[model samples]
Target: MTVPAHHPAPELLLDYAAGSLRAVQSLLVAAHLAYCPECRAQVAELEACGGVLLADLPPEPVSDSLFGTLMTRLDATVATPTPVPAPAGKSLFPGPLRRAIGAEPEALEWVRVVPGVHLSAWGVSAGTASACLLRMAPGSRVPAHRHTDSEMLLVMKGGFSDEFGAYRVGDVASYDTGTPHHAVADADGECLCLLVQDQPLVFTGPLGWLLNRGFRF
Candidate 1:
């Protein structure tokens, strides 16, 4: 994929630097950073600012028993290192996402969302949000839907387009509750993306009703 022209907003980058973004949001940002050097520079600057702030804080005295307590715990315990996930060959997912999903994209079992559209929800639990890989057949059109919470879509293969603009590989499309748009996959090939939603979508119209009945979001 070519260098990404679109990126996560500055506010999102700041939140990421501050460790205030939700887990999935952070993962999305990390994946973008892997492909975007400009954003990586911005995040590095933010971290430097945070380091300066930390250095300026006044030091506090430690409790009298703190040293003894730490020594006793250290002597009594054996720390086990955390296990790391192995790479799944050539994959579109960045490190964090690969760790979360634990397999190559082709290995996942996808469920049909609608005709010509399928998805594989993240195996791990999400806090107040949901993350998944959505796959759309060439020339397919996703039903028009509006969000109840924020949504971020990062294209990993092929392309898709909505009213905002066409998004190719490595491009990101973010939407808040008020932005309602239907996406159509490019006719050339299937479109694959990692989609993170802060809350379930509130799809519009009769078609939405049927879809909502069959699927939770």
Candidate 2:
């Protein structure tokens, strides 16, 4: 595989290494890390720094009841049986993503959102956030839209290009609130991307009024 040209911002990687990123965001970062050795190395360095910081911090006291509760939870966790791993097979999604969605991408039932665009929503516990797989047919273009909050896209297969730049497999594109852009899939092949958004997209095209009317993207 070609090394990805795009990556999560340094601050985002720092949050990921510190274990402070939201679950959905972490999932995207993990998928990107699987394809990015450079980012993985950076994360490792950040983690080491975190460990040093922790060592320098003073210890805090824990109440007996709290400690007992933690022990009980730990015991319960240990008593629980390990889940069986999914049978190995060919797949485009990364391990974190496959586990989150509970299946391979090909096994998902996609819902057509537009003429040549499909979506498969993955129900996960992300407060005020949504996670899904977006698939665009070759040469298909998503209508111009603005993000309501932050949005992150991790290319799983094929590629797409927007005003910012072209994104291929393993590339991560992040957009902040109110940022507007149009995306078109590569002409030769369909593009599949893992998308996590803090809020639904806000369409900014001529049909924006209709598309933004209670439509969840």
Candidate 3:
């Protein structure tokens, strides 16, 4: 696999290291880390810095009630063992994503949202945020759209290019609310990506208006 030129911003990495990111966001970052040695190293550095800062801080006493609650939760967890799902057959998906979806991309059912574009929801969400997989046929173009809150896309296969730039496998692209753009899959092959969004997308233009009336991304 080619080394990725794109990565999550420093602030996002810090939030990830601090365990502050939402479940869906963390999953996207973890998927990116599976393919990005550079981001992995950066995360390790952040963790080390966090540890140093923690060591410098004075210890705070935990309340007895809180400790007891934690102990009870641990005991209950041990008493009721959660079953781990069997691993799906070999796939191109990263470990984090494969574990989350519990199936290969090709094995999952896809729903067409538009011409040459399909989506498979993973049913994972945090508050208003949600996660899904997007598959685009070769040379297909998505309608222009803007995010309502925040959106993150991690390339899992092939590539795509937008107004921002091109993104290949392992690259992560983040968009803030109101940022408008459209992406076209590379002509050479299909594009598969993991998408995590804080809110649904709002489309633009004539085709977009028609799509928005009937569909919700």
Candidate 4:
């Protein structure tokens, strides 16, 4: 595994520790932590802090109907587990993504965004969150774009670089609506990344208007 050069923001780590982040964000964070020991340690510390804070809170009593209502809801709701793929030799893909995608990396059916770039979107809730696998060939570039909500990128293989910095395998690059930047894959090899976003992106470049029409980004 390559050492990560970037990581999720501190606020995100805090949200993750408190279980307050959305499922898509958690999925990206979990995938990053699979290879980032530095972040794992940070999360451990944050969890400890959360534990202390929780312990200090005063206890509250629940309504008499709370348990019955909870049970009723549980009985009414159905659980859908993410399908797991059969072992396909050894895979470098993260467990969380592998489960959600339900297949090995090579098995993903990617949609071409442009030459040398492709995407495989997951069926996460619409307008709430989105998760996908972005594969870029060596030297490929994603046109400059900004997000309406928070977005996170976790490199699974190879690497890419943006205005913020270079990111190798295991690195996580997190951004918000404020920053607009383009990314280019490393020249050495193809790059595979797990990308999670809460809202659509707003492309900002010469081709912004055209790209947005096609990608709805």
Candidate 5:
């Protein structure tokens, strides 16, 4: 299949390869991997590397009672109830996210913004962060903001700019706390991106102060 306009960051992809992402982050990356053969191939290479390393580990014989101890631990873990289905609201980009994130997802709760650009909260894990999709009109300026935690952007369509450079489709950018970044849409068309924010965004003024207090993600 053709690669989507955007690709997940190599770091994020690495995390996926390393199995280090949060459950939701993994889900989104899993969706991306499902569609992108290139990434799938990369992940396979990583798995191969891991296998080689595993092969280098010293072999050791197991003790007999180790099996009984492991089984007791597994039985305890299995006894807990499974998680209930997510409520109609509060679900974040359940796969077939495209099926759920769009002009008409009543659950999306689109935010009010410029006439052309659009934004909506997709995942909210509380004081830690949330995921969002932002669409910008040609030449629109996305506000400059200070990061309290990490920030990542995956360009899905069109392009945008920040102080660092223009990010076209397929480019992934990342920033950690204290970094400053901003964007303006491409001159020719609207830009849409998926953002997994690590901390609440801090605007440049009083509003930001209020937001900082109200929103930690």
Candidate 6:
């Protein structure tokens, strides 16, 4: 299982292996694993490591009926498939990304960034924080810049490259807003990424600031 040039760090896989990643985030990781068998082995290895650690641990005291109860539920589940969390609405959004962000999911209002690039701002009611869905035309590149807050880039389709490495479909790039970098795409190929961010975007130049100010979904 060859990982991309810049794959999620081991910490992320540990979180996933521990089931700490959110469902949405986990969904993307599952997709990435589909492409990377080496990472798959690594995850399995990690899980095995965890299992060994558990083997040495003291067994938890449990009621005698615990085994029977577990078997009962496992038997029942065989007949009924569990429901996947999808959008609850009259009509679902047009894309996988939209549907993945269900539960009072915001709309994707395309706002022009450059001639070939677009961004859709998404807001949440609980916080001033928001996110975005970004699209870039083949070969287009956003100005290299730094972020002020943490950002999550989950690729739904296409790919991009930066100083770190190239990211293809199903890849996620998490960055610290305090750090800075530049990203670009291959010529004539488009890439769509779900940008989950909570802080303001720090533009590197005049146009960048203007675009950020006017950016809205």
Give me candidate 1's TM-score against the actual structure: 0.86
Per-candidate local distance difference test: 0.83, 0.85, 0.86, 0.82, 0.67, 0.66
TM-score of each: 0.86, 0.84, 0.84, 0.79, 0.64, 0.65
- How many pairs of residues collide in each model? 0, 0, 0, 0, 2, 3
lDDT of 2 at 79: 71
Ranking by TM-score: 1, 2, 3, 4, 6, 5
Point out where model 4 deviates above 4 Å: 60-89, 205-210
The reply for model 5, stretches above 4 Å from the true place, is 1-11, 31-38, 54-107, 113-117, 124-127, 206-217
Candidate scoring better on lDDT of 2 and 4: 2
| Candidate 5 lDDT, 34-88, residue by residue in tens | 5577888988888787788789989898998999999998988867688885655
lDDT tens digits, residue span 36-80, model 4:
889899999999999899999998989999999999999998976
Model 5, global lDDT: 0.67
- Best candidate per lDDT, number? 3
The window of 10 residues in a row where model 5 has the poorest summed lDDT is: 91-100
- lDDT, candidate 6, residue 175? 83
Name the TM-score of candidate 3: 0.84
In terms of lDDT, model 1 sits at 0.83
